[model samples]
Each structure stands twice: as structure tokens, then as C-alpha cells.
Target: MSPSLLAALLYAALTLLLLMTIAALRATLVITRQRTADAFTPAGDDVSPFSGRLCRAHANCCENLPVFGVLVVTAALSGHADITDPTALWVVAARVGQTVTHLGSGRRRAIRLRFLFMLVQIALLTTWAARLLWGAMQ
Candidate 1:
């Protein structure tokens, strides 16, 4: 498979991992009879700090996945995998870095590092999209 496709799959896996973490946390609470299933807030505000960070991390993935997905799909469909293949894994790496940084701490330094990761991803993806579109127009 192309690196771009593999990156997309990895991105999806990362998202799923976050979701599973949230589910497991909630399940633990329910199973331990600490909280009812229906008592949890959607944003995880009522939960512990880690839960809140998990929710935010998952949400960040959800928010950005489609942008990455659509770009990767477009590249494949439009014969522009060449545009994305080189930096695809880098994008995934940045994505993972962003999430890891987000999950690691909520301090200002960590937040800045997370933002840098996110910026790396956005810049790479944007470059890919622009290249693909530009190539298509040729």
C-alpha cells in the first residue's frame, strides 16, 4: 500500500485508540459502581483530569481526521499519491506527537508543543492538498 494510505490507516487507528481509552475509563467507572452510565458528561467534565484530556485528544482527532482523510483519498483517487506519499508518515508522526503531548500534560509548555505538532500536520496536509489541486489544474 502507498505510504499515504498507510498513514491514513494509522491515523484512524490512533483515533480508535483514543475512543477505546475513553470507553474503558467509563466502563471502569460503571463496573466499579462509582458512577452510573448515564451520569457522565459528554465532554468528560465531571470525570477526572485524564479523562478530560482524553476527550479533548479524541475530539482533536475527530476534528482533523476528515481533513486528512479527504486529502489522502483525493490524492489516491486523482493519481496524486506522489504528492502525499513522501510526507504522509511525517504527518502521522506529527499527529501522534500532538495527541501524546496533549495527553501528557496540560501545562503551557506542553500545550505549545502540541500546537507545534498540530501546525506541522496542518502545514504538510495543506501543502499536499495544494500540490494535488495544482497538479490537477495542469
Candidate 2:
């Protein structure tokens, strides 16, 4: 198969992986929320990880995944995979960073690293999209 086709398939696979991660995160948040709500007391604080802006965080992450996926797919479909290596590497690195953050030590540190990785991933994807658009216009 052609390089472009392979790149497209890889991007699609990454998108699916993102979807699956979102689903799992949602489920975990739901359980956490339910437990917190059920255990609420008159004098005690419901210190649930799911209570403070986690839904928004998850939503934001989900939003970016599709944007990245679309850009990568479009570039690959437009015969731009040769130029897509940098973006693909960025995506892969971001994924690895995310996994490490999720499974590594230091919650605060992990959170910051994950956010940075996501930002880098978004930037890479946006750059790829802009390049593809410029090429199309040429």
C-alpha cells in the first residue's frame, strides 16, 4: 500500500484509541461522581476527583483528538504523507507522554506533563492542517 494510505490508517487508529480512552475516562468519572454524591454528609466535604472540572477537562481533551485526527487524515489523503512525518511523530510522542503521565509517579507533575503534551499535539496537528491548506491553494 501507498505511504499516504498507511499514514491515514495510522491516524484512524490513533483516533480510535483516543475515543476508547475518552470512554474509559468518562466511565471512571461517572463512578466517582456517583460515589461522592451518595456519600455526601452535612458537615463533611465531598472531596471527589470527579467533582471539580473533570468533565470539562475530559471534554477539552476529546475535542482536540478529533481535530488532530482530521488534520492528519486530510494531509495523508491529499498525498502529503511525506511531509506528515513530523506531525505523526508529535502525535506518537504525545500519546506516549499521556500514557506515562497516567501511569507514573507524582500526580501534579503528571497533570502538567499531560497538558503540555496535549498542547504540543494540537500545535503539530494545526501546523499540518495549515500546510495542507497552503499546498491546496498553490
Clashing pairs in 1: none
TM-score of 1: 0.97
Which stretches of candidate 1 lie above 4 Å from their native place?
none
What total of clashing residue pairs does each candidate reach?
0, 0
Worst 10 residues of 1 by lDDT: 42-51
lDDT of 2 by residue, 41-137 (tens): 3222243344223333434445565765576667767778766764576576675566446445347877898788777776777777788889999
How many clashing pairs in candidate 2?
0
* Candidate 2 least-lDDT 10 residues: 42-51
Give the top-scoring candidate (lDDT).
1
